[model samples]
Target: MTMTKIAFFDAHSYDRDSFEMWNKDFGFDIHYYKERLSMNSIELTKGKEIVCVFVNDEISAQVIDALVKNGVKLVALRCAGFNNVDLPEAKGKLRVVRVPAYSPHAVAEYAVTLMLSLNRKVYRSTQRTREGNFRLSGLLGFDMYGKTAGIVGMGRIAKVLVNILKGFGMNILAYDKFPDMKWAKENGVKMVDLPELYANSDVISLHCPLTHETLHMIDKDAIDMMKPGVMIINTGRGKLIRTEDLIQGLRSHKVGSAGLDVYEEEAKFFYEDHSDRMINDDHLALLLMMPNVIVTSHQAFFTREALQNIATTTLQNCKDFLDGKELVNEVMAK
Candidate 1:
């Protein structure tokens, strides 16, 4: 029997470490690539049966076609979101699988981390203290207790966040197309409409997946609906909030603070460091310059536990496929 070969793209040191450790159980031949999977890198998949990709990889229709041509049978996504993958094109050509629920607590806790860090001006204070300028002049933060937190999306991560916010004594207002009424009632979370959530929440955190209807959901109109000086935190996809509109909102004092783990154009710059080079993306640069905004490089799901789960689940997905068993995490076209 031939050993299974996998071409893993957008692989960092952490990814290589986790996958290599986990591959001991499966004994698959894995080739890790530092560069993202793109048209130029399609040649790497020539002899591989599977191509494992991270969030930043370019998995377009053309790339999918090339993968099929290169004898790639599967495209395994290491991350939850599949917005980057062209599913329609890969319908029959390629089988796609993803690690959908790897350490929800990691993301939920990160969302809360961003919220607290932004609200308390922790980043600003730390910078001042480091420079020997500990002045308590511009650092006034509101109490999380007795505050309203609106959460969009009632997925695993959102539920975890709800529990955390409830512990903080926050009134939770959640909006999900398919609301879990029983769960919400038990957890003391009020299921409300988007408009109601927008109008009432002191802090709004986004956890929804990026879809056609949800793309640019937080634009000028949504910002107008929100409370004055609202704090926005996004641990989900970046396109959920329009970057240009968000910058305008910040400048207009409509959005008091923003904690972003992802950005719309983050693919070009997120995982890799470009501190020495100039940031060509104007919107990203502007957001970074803002005192109230905290931009993270999409590391909300970077916990050790999450990495292990991702590696195990992803390899299991491959094992199941090769064994002709039902793939529990297989992603199919709608």
Candidate 2:
């Protein structure tokens, strides 16, 4: 039996160990990289049949074309988001498959955790307490028992969020292009218009993919429509929020507090250690300066369950495609 040759460009330090642990049965010639996948990576993947990628990888037209030219047939993504890949260019050029439905509970729980941390100001208080100051003067947190939570998308993760928030006794208001009427009725979630969701929700969480229409969807106009002191949480793609406008909203108290796991310019910063160097993205720097903002380096999907699931699914996607079966999680261009 000929072992498959698969190259994982932009593979994280954590990925190799986890993948090896899960797929021990496979006869794979696995190649790893510490840096990001770019046009320069073309030469590295010259003889490989498949290339596995992650969130921050550059899957541009040129890169995809080069991969196809170099005998690479499959693009297997370990993560759910595919905005980095140029799908139109990849259409018919490469068979792209992603781990679409990993642990939704991981992301949904992270979103709520951010909301609670911001409401109680835990990040600030924890820092102060570590320095021998045990003051609790400004740590007043409201009960989320009756507040309405507006979910912007109704994907699997958002559905899990609705169920979790229900246990907190919170009302649910959701807006989606194709509303989940049955789920809404079963879960007591009201499928409302976008404007209504903005005006009514006490906390708003973003859970959709990034697209041209959704890029900066939380801009000035959307912010203006939102209720004052509304808490914002995003565990989805970072490009959905306009970072500059979000900063302004925080400044004006239009947004009371924010819990963000992703950022617009995070590709350069996340998965890298830059504590010794100057931070380049001014918006990210400024965001760190704010006392009310809570930012995590995109670790919402980093649970042990999620990681194992991701690695298993990604490897299976490659093996399944090579076996001439239909894709289990294929990304088709609409």
Candidate 3:
């Protein structure tokens, strides 16, 4: 029996712990690297048959060329989003598989958590109470029950969020390229066009994938269409919202508040601790200075259950590829 050797790039302690725990049962020889996968780091996969990557790994055309040269047969992604990988370039050369659904509840719950925190001024109240300044001067919040929520995508994660929001007695309006009318009718969600959703929703949340059509979808025009003082929450890919346009909206008070777990240029700053260094990204720095904006380091999908599921699914994908089984999780270019 030939043992399959896999190289996991951009690996962290949590990744190691979860993957290694499952590897004991799979009996695969896996090597872990702390550095992210890029053209410069391609040599790390010298003799490996499979290379595993995360959300931030760079799998461009150049990187794909190097992977082909390095005898890599498969690329395993531990996360759902695969915009970073060049699918067109890797079509005939190598196969790509990803964990499509790890834990939708983790992300959906976090989205609501951000909405509640921002709406109720939880963060500000915590800070104020810590300093013994318990005064309810500016901590007023409106009722979420009477407002309308527009969801961009109605996939598994979005469905979970829609259910939760429906429990709060909020009206639901959703838009998707391929709309599921049956699901919407069953869940009491109204299917609407983007313009309608934007114009009527008091709170908008993004759950769409980042693609050619959806990239920078929330620009100045979209912001202009939204209700004034509307709250925005994003746990999806960063490029979905244009940072410059968001900044412009914030400046003019067109967007009242924002809760973001991802940013467009977050590759250099998201997963690392940069408390000691001065942030060099001017746009990110400017967003950080705004009190109405809350920026997290893309941690919505970091729950233990999600990590364990990701490890299990990723390993299952590797096993399926090696055993010549069907790749249900394979992502192909559209």
Candidate 4:
């Protein structure tokens, strides 16, 4: 069967390799575009039924209209975040599908990895050991067992995170709009309201989406409600926690440490190396300067298993849309 061609925009070195390795079984005419996909790149997707996008691509209303005009019917996002996509504009214009929960364990484990690496100062100690310095000073870390973990959002990633922490006997306190009471009971997790979760937890991790209601949810008021010296981890959307408020928390000793995998303005510089150039974003620079803060380049979902699953799902999403079949991961604009 001759498969429908799919144009993969922002097909970086890593992205192309991962997609090619997993999508060999699927009959897809994959055209790779290493450059970031913008409205200007709409012509490249012409005659293609689908366009697969990455984290860096701009899929706004203008781009959506352009894609439709260029004969693209479906937009498959390999990543989970849909903030960049103008869903309302694309409503009935083009089908939008995403790999919503591809390898939740990958992101969940990365969150824990950040927590442990920062808590024990493992990265610092490893650096010193390489220099033949056997100093244990300033490397103290508290036990995770018996510690209280407050998880915001009880989504797939958050559920896996809670389960991982459960192995260490960590008490889980969760907050969500539609809290999973059954899961909480089964896991011995306490589903509390937001304010209590903030004020009482030893470690607070955000696993929520970025929406108007959730924007800067961890601002000054939320930070003020948090326990002093509490550790904050955000492996989810960056806008959930205000960077300025986080800086204030770090400076005021309200937040002991931060393990961040995403940032609000990260689309500008992330997935690209700029060693020779000076940083243009002051907020990122300020966060980087903090000893108690650690940032990863939105890499919580960068594991091989996750990438393969994402690629397969993305291709399938495109195929489904072209075949006039129901899209399992379709994001319908309300």
User: By the TM-score metric, which is better: model 3 or model 4?
Assistant: 3
Off by over 4 Å in 4: 1-3
Q: Write the per-residue lDDT of candidate 4 for residues 162-202, one digit (tens) a residue.
A: 99999989999999999889988998999999999999999
Question: What digit string (tens of lDDT, one per residue) describes model 3 on residues 145-256?
Answer: 9799999999999999999999999999999999999999999999999999999998999999999999999999999999999899999999999999999999998998
lDDT of 2 at 150: 98
Model 2 lDDT-worst window of ten: 20-29
Candidate 3 is scored at a TM of 0.98
lDDT of 2 by residue, 231-284 (tens): 999999999999999999999999998889999999989978899998988999
Q: What lDDT would candidate 1 get against the real structure?
A: 0.95
Model 4 alpha-carbon miss at residue 242, Å: 1.1
Considering only N, C-alpha and C atoms within 3 Å, which residue pairs clash in candidate 2?
none
How well does each candidate superpose onto the true structure, as a TM-score?
0.99, 0.98, 0.98, 0.96
Clashes by residue pair, model 4: none
Cα lDDT of model 1 by residue, 52-138, tens digit:
998889899999999999999999999999999999999999999999999999999999999999988999999999999989988
Q: Give the TM-score of candidate 1.
A: 0.99
Best by lDDT: 1
Worst 10 residues of 4 by lDDT: 315-324
How much does candidate 2 score in TM-score? 0.98
Model 3 regions more than 4 Å off = none
